[model samples]
Target: MKITVIGTGYVGLVAGACFADIGNEVWCVDVDQTKIDKLKQGIIPIYEKGLEPIVNKNFQEGRLHFSTNLLDGFDQSQFIFIAVGTPSNPDGSVDLKYVYAVAEEIAKNLKDYKLIINKSTVPVGTGKQLRDFIDQKIKERGINVDFDIVSNPEFLREGNAIEDFMNPDRVIIGTESIRAKEQMNELYSGLFKDAEPRIIFMDVRSAEVTKYASNSMLATKISFINEISNLCEKVDANVEMVRLGVGADKRIGYSFISPGIGYGGSCFPKDVKAIINTGNEYGYDMKLLKAVELINETQKAHLFDKIQNYFDNKKDGLKGKTIAIWGLAFKPETDDMRESPSQVIIRKLVEGGTKIKAHDPEAQNEAKRLFKDIETSIEYFDDNYECLKDCDALALLTEWNIYKQPNFQLIKKHLKNPIIFDGRNQYRPSEMKEMGFDYFSIGR
Candidate 1:
């Protein structure tokens, strides 16, 4: 199958590479000439695990190609996937400019019957709107052609996008056309041959709603656990133990139960807001989701307050303090900093005139670009422990493995004070106390 994936962003690049790796001829279309040129030279823009090698192999084998010209991609492919970003607008609606632009371009260049798949997470009824827009445009041009618009939203998480794509738990196809369904199933059958990932079939609107609902559920679990963790701390209980007790029930299960600063990435924040906006448009309120959003916001701020309150009624005490941040990425294994709690925590500390020495196994350089304005305020370290040297205290913002079971002896020896604030609950409070280090964690 010849497939063209428009918008070579995180989702597009990973989908394109994986499709090509599975023997489909893929042409990745992006408007950015520089990005396409770099990709042509084996340069990948994003830092996703196992992506570069797969992309290189596919390109070398003539299975994958990169292009800046949409027409070239359109002319050579039977299936066109719009994998562009639909960022959240100020009103919480998904900004569909990029997706619409790609759809319009595909409409203009429709030479034959093609299967148009929407792989970007979009609002319900977007597929119908896109189909109408394309059909109307083609009619205006006096060209009678047929194309099937199918909703196939992606559920890949960052830092593990390749693995998720290669071994998805399920494949969803939302289309009314039987021909389109057959073609879609054929496209993915080879990928899930033996594992037999369940292929879910539904209406287009249901498929769109599924993506938002899935992320919203995950976000709700995070906020729910965080709320419980807060209560556990107040009542002198351990959230980890509570999580273990509840997760033992086969019905409850135990994923996304860790009490963290908050959930942040490209998906959850935007999708929750978008779904809330959708409810508002339909004259119904998503009260629980609204609370979930509020909880996440409060969780991000709580980390800041924890550090300030630890200083305990002392003004300007943090002014000259040097704090070491162990992780800067939103999570481990990816360099994405979008909506990262590290941003909020670091920004607050910097405002209080505290110097910061941050280190991540892979996100250091990305952090440099993110905090470009703070020239004299922050320093990046390649070695995680090196950041602890001469620092007043350490803040574990993201749970990177190197910082998990560290040489506590070295940390105690190097820091100006043996104090640590762990936002991720990566360390045990009782053990840190026994080690003679002042420790603060989310909920025990």
Candidate 2:
């Protein structure tokens, strides 16, 4: 199969590389000439685990290609995937300019029957709109060409994207065209051969809504647990124990239940807002989702408030204090800092006249870029221990594996006060108290 994936961002690059790895000839198209040139030279633009090696291998094996010209592989490609970004607007609506632009380009270059798959996360009814848009463009061009639109939204997690792409929990195919469905089945047959068939066939609108609903549900879980954690704090109860009791039920498996600052990434925050906006657009208010969004926003500031209270207890405010941030990325094993809690915490601390030293295994450079305006107030360090030197307290933001179990002695020796704020609840309160250090954690 010959496949062309437009927009070489996270989704496009991963999908293209994985398809090529499965023996399909894939061409990744992007308008940016510099990005295309870098891809040709085996330079990956993003950090996804196990992606670079597979992309390089596929490119070297002649199964993968990158180009700036969208028409370069259109004639030969049987399937073209629009995997562009649909970032959120100020009102939380999705900006579909890129997706629509790609559709127009494909319509102009369509030479044969092709399956146009919407691999980007989009609003419901986008497939129908895209089909109509392309048909209108073709009519104006006085060309008769057939194309089927399929909504095949991606479910790849950032840190584990390659694994998710290769071994997805389920593959969704949303199209009414039997011809398009047949091609999609054949294309994915090799990947799903060993596992039980998990391909879900649904209507286009249902498929589009599934992506947003899935993220929104997960975000709700995070907010639910955060709310519980807040109550636990007020009632003098431990959230860890409550979580254990609640999660012990087989019906409620423990995932995304850990109380943290909040959920942050490209997906959760954006998808929740998008879904809420979608509901409002249809004259139905998503009251539960609105509360979920509010809780997450409040949770992002929870850790900063904890820090301020800790200093206030000592009769020395956060002013002139230096705090060490152990993690800058939203989560571990990826350098994505979009909507990271560390940004919220650090920004508030800086505004309060507090200094920061932050470190992350992969996100230090990204942290520098994100916090460039406050360069004078914050420092980036490669070593976590170095970040703690002379700091008032250590605020563990992202739960990186390296920061899980460190030299507590070294942390105690370096910090001016032996205090730790564990946003992710990575440390046990009893253990921290036994170690003779003041410990603060989320709901425990």
Quantify all predictions' global Cα lDDT against the true fold. 0.91, 0.93
True-vs-predicted CA distance for residue 206, candidate 2, Å:
0.5
> Clashes in model 1: which pairs?
none
For model 2, how does the per-residue alpha-carbon lDDT over 186-252 read when each residue is reduced to its tens digit? 8888686954378888899999999999999999999999999999999999999999999999898
The RMSD of every model to the true structure, in order and in angstroms, is 1.3, 1.1
Instruction: Output the TM-score of candidate 2.
Output: 0.98
Candidate 1: minimum summed lDDT over ten consecutive residues — where?
Answer: 309-318
Model 2: lDDT to the true structure: 0.93
Best by TM-score: 2
* Residue 211 alpha-carbon offset, candidate 2, angstroms: 0.6
Error of 1 at 250 (Å): 1.4
lDDT of 1 by residue, 78-188 (tens): 899999999999999999999999988998899899999999999999999999999999999998999999999999989899989988988889999999998998999
Q: Positional deviation of 21 in candidate 1, in angstroms?
A: 0.8
- Candidate 2 residue runs with Cα over 4 Å from true position: 194-196
